[model samples]
Target: MPVESSALPPADTVSVAGLIDNIRGRDHRQSRLAWEIYTDIERIHALTLDRPPELDTRVFDHFANSSALLGAVNHIDKSHADALVNEALALVHRIPLTGLCLYDGIINQRQFQLLVSVTDLVDGWPSAPDVDKQIAKDLQDNGPGSTRRLRDLTKRAIFAHDPDAVRRRAEQARARRTATVRPRPDGMAHLGITAPAEDAQLAMAAVEALIAAAICPHDPRKKNARRSDAAMNTLQGIPLVCQCGREDCTATPRGAGMSDLHARIVVHVICQDGTLGGDSHDGGGPDEGGPQDSPDGGPGSEDPGGDGSDDGPGDDGPSDDGPHNSGPECGGDAERPGFLDGYGVITADHVRAIAQRPDAIIRPLNPKPGQALPTHQPGDPYRFSAALDTFIRARDGYCVFAGCNKPAWACDLDHVDEFNHDDPAAGGQTSAGGANAKCRYHHLIKTFGEWLDDQFVDADGRTRVTVTSPDGVTIEGRGHTNEMLFPALRTVRFQKPPPRGPTTPAADDPNNGSGPRRTRTRTADKHARRRRERELNRRFRELHDFGPPPDDRR
Candidate 1:
């Protein structure tokens, strides 16, 4: 009923490039090919595991060397390779081929199949040769005849299998996996539960427990009781109570008392709508047996909620004993004598001139009463001002640490010399001198860690600062400073200027005619005379026909 392959067109007749092009075009075709190869490897892995105890190493070696099998199939990209390898390895470990053949004595069939699949996927037939050699060497060193008894034991363990025993052992493993407890937002603990499959009853129980643990309030019609108590009643005889106090307080309250109290406190503190706990007034109970009256009558009151006038004093206004001052009125010479006296009233235009005037001197608002002025003043006030300006400009660079990019303007000017007398020698530099801009954190690290040993010295031999590492390494000196720490005014690489236009040649014979081309003078005139004397000896030898020089001399 079916057509014979001999009657059909040969696959070789189709171009290999065309075949590849066809495969590339269809996503499903590529995926199917990859999965087919993966499934084959999985089957091969299982057969290797099911073999007799003594045959595992030989079987595994064959799988590992099967590079031809792996490379023959396509879809060897990162994602496909990873997924296939992972799935195969998972099965191998589950059956535990590696454990039985190497370290652990027990093995599961499922685990063996998985491992074989992974090994085949990773190492194809061509790659298998190297794996074979390695395995053979390991067997030679650690097989039955090895000097180490433990090595032999390990070898036996890697090949052994026990399907039922493994399954039983996995029970404890599953428990350990599920034992982890995650913390709830309300500070309660919850155990994670994972089953072979989802069970509705179990899931519902977990949900019910969570709901019970949560402090949901009861309906107002039900006297605003705890939801835990209501949930307990819903689940009859399922106790939900404070679980505290002396022996006899077993009456379940539906939810945990502690959780309820905590939830109540949180609601009271964080409720933006101002609805939880109670109304704004103290005496507003839930059931008062009458329609509640609004605080400002039935919605349309002329009182405008409190008081109508915007500026007028209300219930919360200042009392007589408050900071109310009834003082004399302003603008009168008699009532407030010196209100306008001695006050200079200058117009806005005059401000600039007053500020720029050479004779302008502004006194300090709160100068020390008896403090004496400095006896030895350094230059004029303007010179001092200029020095300050220069100091600010020079120190405009950011915190001077490699990779630290803090701006200098944003930092504090730290004194290298401490101002306090008690720790005079503490900060390194002398008193009343030396300061550098540093951020608050860096300043603390420098000061407390006593890292002033690290410093940058300027050309004048003045120590700028030092930042020493905790490891006792000193980072100091001038040119070695990190440029990243300082603000870069310009980059270091040089740029060449653009070429100029060609100059026009001067017109020939237009003026006094072309001048003679200048010749370069030689500096070896004396040397030339010495060279001529040397050449005379050679000329004389040629004229006299002197005998040939001795062989050794020649």
Candidate 2:
């Protein structure tokens, strides 16, 4: 179909529009290539430096801006661009030089302002999987305060200054969050001690002592077992009493201590027995052989007592019998009968309630009250004493970690090696031999994480501890050693390097300074200037299109 000449725009106008479209396309392609090159730079840099390939968006931005200078070189010859990149790489090879360059690259006046805005609003850049990339994209598209904002002003400022500083700040924030505190309505309040995170641990020795004290008074083997049981039950607010007594003696009320101790003892005893039956269940009874006969031909009967025969004392006299019958049972009515039918029976279920309460104090039933303490067996006393001494020294009268001040005496001694049935390598003799102490929280970490591998062997053959932080720092002794145990306690300062000068081309060089190098620089500067002009024009056009300025001509 032939188009009318009047309907179409002028040829010159069409050509201009085409030229504009071509320029836009070229701009888009160049921008895309620049971004790709930036990504490549980052990947190569991270790999070469042995750092994590994924960097914070803020770090990426820093590198991107620095590489923008390279974009300027793109306008010149390829050889010049290559030289600039090579120079940059060479500088980066020196560790301190790289740090300084990255710092300079990220912290110019414009970058500083942007970093502050981002950090102030966003809280901080996230370090999770793919998060930094997302954050960078959002910052570019929507600017600060957007949904994808990554950091607050403070964090941004810190990051722009030094990435390590930002990292340290983040770690401190996390530690503050996890630090121990009193329970509050909103959550744990960041007050009180900051001991290692842990569950409350109980000492077996303390538990045993408590249990013994509680139950010793009511022990059936005691002098006045019935009276003591009644007294204990009264103290403990329980109904437990000696059924051996007819009075149903309810004098002493049971305290938490008495009830708990009794229950624990009962359970312990029953567990020892396997079946719930008491010591009586283990047989110590007479043999199955019939009773021995008397030498006097007195009633030769199966029963220990004679069957109405009077070969010596007219059926009532004692008879001379074999060794088995020598004990008075050979004569009439000399055998003692089994326990009476009406004796009381103690059941395991009766004590179940008291056994499970955490606050309840347990006691042993048979320990001698007010009696001299038993001498601890040789190896046993030394082991326990050594462990206790180590705990006291390492903890230094309080929790070793910063901000935690829990008294060492109040803390429980935790075994570094958990006593578990699974993982035979961690069980029995091997684990027992490897035991080291920690408070409840550190114990949990060791049992549940990589802290199990963190150990220290002391001069006395006792193993201490080592803690590896998330940042790959290894802290030893829990502050027991001379060195600063926490990164927070240490200070890091950086010194800026001197500025670089322009490079001079050698006379022998094939390409003169005006060759590829000069061309690249000139082209880059031209592109930058063009971009600036375009941006300014766009802004001005928008302003003019929106409204005319107010007339101030008086």
Expressed as tens digits, the lDDT of each residue in 247-311 for candidate 2 is 44433333444434433221111111111122212111111111122222111122232211101
Model 1 Cα shift for residue 482 (angstroms): 13
TM-score of each: 0.18, 0.18
lDDT of 1: 0.30
lDDT of each: 0.30, 0.29
Q: Name model 1 segments beyond 4 Å from true.
A: 1-394, 422-433, 453-456, 460-464, 479-554
TM-score of 1: 0.18
